[model samples]
Target: MKALLLVVLAALPVSAKLVSREQRLDLVRRARLRQAVDPSTMDLLNGPQGDGSFKVGEAVSCKYEEKDPLHPLGGHSPKFPCWTKSGERLKVKYKGEANPEVYGEVAGSRLLWALGFYSERMYSVKIVCENCPADPWTSTKESPRAVRTFEPATVQRRLKGTEVSEVEGEGWKFSELDHVNPAKGGATQAEADALRLLAVFMNHGDNTANQQALTCLEGDPDCKAPVMYVTDIGGVFGGKGYFTSYRHWTKKKSLWKDAGNCVADYKTTDEKSNDPEISEAGRKLLADLLGKLSEKQVRDLFLGARFDDLSKRQPPFIWPDGKSRPLTVDDWVKAFLEKRAQVASARCPR
Candidate 1:
């Protein structure tokens, strides 16, 4: 009976066999070590077919190839460096499990590609090897792992014009816009201009992760004046969704109304939530900045349309209860302008 059992086990397909805990632990260990050695280097290891070796400072490119039936969005792929002898670059194809989490990897890879780095392939490596004490991780012994390897020259060619310098203190950094301290004073005009554009961009993109100011400077401080640019664009519309209404309870009506007054309120709430110094500083800066813009301009910038245009259209104002009334952009703009003016007056005091 024992001999029969051994024979049956031997006949089982390799892919069908489960990996032992020790083996899993080994893989985890190797992955963690790889991450510690270089956090950016092992970005692709989370994929299914992302096995193989890579050196530090090597450029890699990857893309999603297949969708997992269960996940329909996430899966794995191999990582390819920019300068392999075979002259291969680009994630030619993806073959592995499709899961939503895998979609996140694809999203991340797309972001990196947009930022301009070149390499082919991606894999899943361990993040904390020391934390994992079970099966150790190992690359597949099969030749396919090697066959997937490609030359780095091809990656360089594809990355031509996509390279973004990853210089610290020179590129993008994050910050808050509404907070101001008495000692720090308000943001300068230039800072306010940048922050205004950034706030619109963030709102349009549905980004809420960063409520502080961020600076993206080009080049080194000693080398030359840094050109400030937007660092985080991930909050844009395609990545997330946004809402445009505020809830207010009217004492007279004893009912809730969609005030459309929430955006500024939200910003104010965010500002006051910060430390006193930072909050004061941001308030002063924003008040000064808003003072420069006409109420019409603020409406146009945030609402994506002029009050006149909205008035001409006379769009219906639909209440949350499904009742609709004729309303125009002017109506919303007038209310918003009054509220903002009140806020500015209270906060800035001319």
Candidate 2:
């Protein structure tokens, strides 16, 4: 099927009048998905593997490979693709050392992986591209020379799964749990509700329709019981503008609007947040997972994302400024524990 799609597409003229841009891209996406999938290798929680857990400061050399090559729209966050020496294709989304999203994305995925969820097999690795690109995250341009890229850049091995959502690129919604829940989509309802709570915990500000994905754990085209997973989590751990502000994040740590009825009132941009109500099971599940984190593991969450170096930036952090203050590992650990305490708080809805 993969070969046939390409063979047929290659035969068609570039000027095919009837095909829309979406149609053409969908064609390419499906073909690539089929070609790259290895059914036996499919595992939702397959990582936060050796690469994501260990490669900070030490540069992992890679050759730049242009995937999108061109960003349809220009943006600040520069994310592009590269192939490591071991031949793993990774998506690198790095802004710089000062940018909190770098830490947020890595921490979010790693935390999710730790909590036993299907998440990006992402690691924070220093990058040196042999054939570097100029703003490759949004432009197709490249440089011929080797370039040292951002520090603590998130390097995530691409995830593969059969599409289970009705819309291809536009993924499922928090409202549409039937598309990914076990009672309906095969993932536990507690998992779905816990995700909503998790989004609030992070004060997620970029929960777009396409951010979460619904897909089968298997690579089979006919795979049923698809599970939902967060495909991109870069904009977490902060509120408006996705800033890694300690004051803002810690200031509003409450997870409930009406704890007795299990209502949530944290910040979010997801319009599909209404259907799933928080349950005791969901809250407990998250709290239980968080409770399992050892002291070292809890600290690793921020250290892995390079939160310690944030205070040492050129223009050092100042007091009373949440955004400007240098958030050390200690600061993050304290905040994290407080947040965990909120999750496990005895005052939660029964």
Candidate 3:
């Protein structure tokens, strides 16, 4: 079907219509933030259409692909390409030293989605290793690369002048178009403000374009405007942890506790600024979304990343000082709730 669409589009003359960067970004922001007021639509998108939330008792299976790339994060934990019994393919990683990283990624994705931000579907599925190939750990593996999240036609349209370049310094073997820095181009004021607020809220320090992808509705290349999603979100929710050098995550209420009218690190321009119109709406939307979740649902969001066999408290966390305590599901949920309150209070005052 996609091939046929491409063929049909190819026969037509190139779209002489030029879409300005601002227009494209505005379209994207609307599509993303629009989900807030539409519950029925949210359910539909969050359902099987988009990456739905993981369900309890879902059958899961795993098999190691020696050719699959290993994420640097999996150094302590192992990762494998897995499929739910329903045939949803996912990249599964075991939790060991990378426990917080996996949890943060899953939490961030869920929270952002709950708040109506476009995010890739991610969930926890326990891999039945019995069905996997022999000596999975011993098999040869390659380093991870950025997965192509956009359709071919959309990529061509959105990135006309941007050059695809190899990331120097990093030992990256793959190439992808640069699309992360919204300030460089292709970002609306609303999106810029929303993204910055989310970053501070989640302590998402990594705002590099590489961590994001401009995807479309139902993977359609010809969709009017491609929406942005954080396809790679493993680097989130690290507050004061010594090992959490990638993103800042804190259980304490600090980043946005007093977020008044401005976001740090984001510049104000005629085109983009800490606009109250966007930020105020975003705060209400996020707070309302967080209110809809139950403690159990929040707990499930965290456990969704860990192996199924582990108990709710099975993977007890140890701090850098060697003093260890189990990170309970309730405790995690409480932290989120506290943050949600702070966010609501920080919005443009009523």
Candidate 4:
């Protein structure tokens, strides 16, 4: 019976789509207020470890793949691009770091779901073994484009602005998804605002096209409006120096006044501004969703990232303390909860 079921499932069409920025914007434009964001876009988030179990698979085998020179996914960390298989299948980057990238992937996806935005379904898995198959899929590289990078001078100019919200250095530039394809593709004001809010929440500095996707319908590449997914989400909870800043955004005063105006400099500077990105309803929804997380859920988020007893294991990055030792799980959770409280306070009804 199990074999029969497996065969039946295999026969069924696989409608998985990698949603892109352009496609997401189009959906937002057509959607009603707070209705632009689709929950089903990241169906994988509802998997076995959505609560934050750091197990990608048991007895995993990683097949090494080629790295793209033009559009590299792993910035500084040595990227061992490989095909991962345990129960679920994924093309993963085996980046064994002092702080693994899986933590960021888990955190970003979790928050995106809580905040009610389309996100990628990612997991932090342990690779027990490696078996590099001769043929492995790698990301294709496009022709070189003179993409702008934020210089030090630009950061200074941005900091001088009236609004406190600002993206750090080069690589943190806002995605040109809308600008490049305004007529056919582009986000609604609300969707754009939500993106900015998400960036602030995750301390997301990487706004490049690679970080996002516009997946097509089931087996249909022609379906451009299928779904959207934020691909490069593991670059959060860090600094704002690069597109994937390792900075964290825990302080309330450091962020925008509200989720609606996260992109401070661009809000007033850009003439193409439209409606607010995140609506009151949206904020309340996010607050409610985040508020509903149980203690287990919260703990699981960090635990899945392998955050636990400091004595037993140290954290990845050391920001607010010793340059050598990593932060404690307790401290990390506390800071996260503090930020969550701030989010609820500002957005939720008093």
**RMSD, every candidate, angstroms:** 19.7, 7.8, 10.4, 13.4
Candidate 3 lDDT, 139-212, residue by residue in tens: 44333332211100000011111111122111111011123334443444444455556655565544455455
Across 76-183, the per-residue lDDT of candidate 4 in tens digits comes to 533334443443333444433333354555566656654455554455455532444322222233323221111000000000001000121111124432332324
User: Residue 276 in candidate 3 has what lDDT?
Assistant: 27
Q: Which stretches of candidate 1 lie over 4 Å from their true place?
A: 1-205, 208-224, 227-278, 299-315, 318-323, 348-350
Return whichever of 1 and 4 wins on TM-score. Answer: 4
**Ordering by lDDT:** 2, 3, 4, 1
Give every collision pair in model 3: 124-304, 180-209, 237-249, 238-248, 238-249, 239-249
Superposed Cα deviation of residue 185, candidate 4 (Å): 14
lDDT of 3 at 231: 50
User: Cα deviation in Å at residue 129, candidate 2?
Assistant: 1.1
Kindly indicate the candidate among 2 and 4 with the higher TM-score.
2
lDDT of 1 by residue, 172-232 (tens): 1223223322123333433432243223312323223231112112232121111222322
Assess every candidate by TM-score: 0.30, 0.74, 0.57, 0.55
Winner by lDDT? 2
Kindly list the per-residue Cα lDDT of model 2 for residues 7-35, writing each as its tens digit: 11111111111233443233323321111
Score candidate 4 by lDDT: 0.41
Query: How big is the positional error of residue 207 in model 1, measured in Å on the Cα after superposition?
Result: 3.2
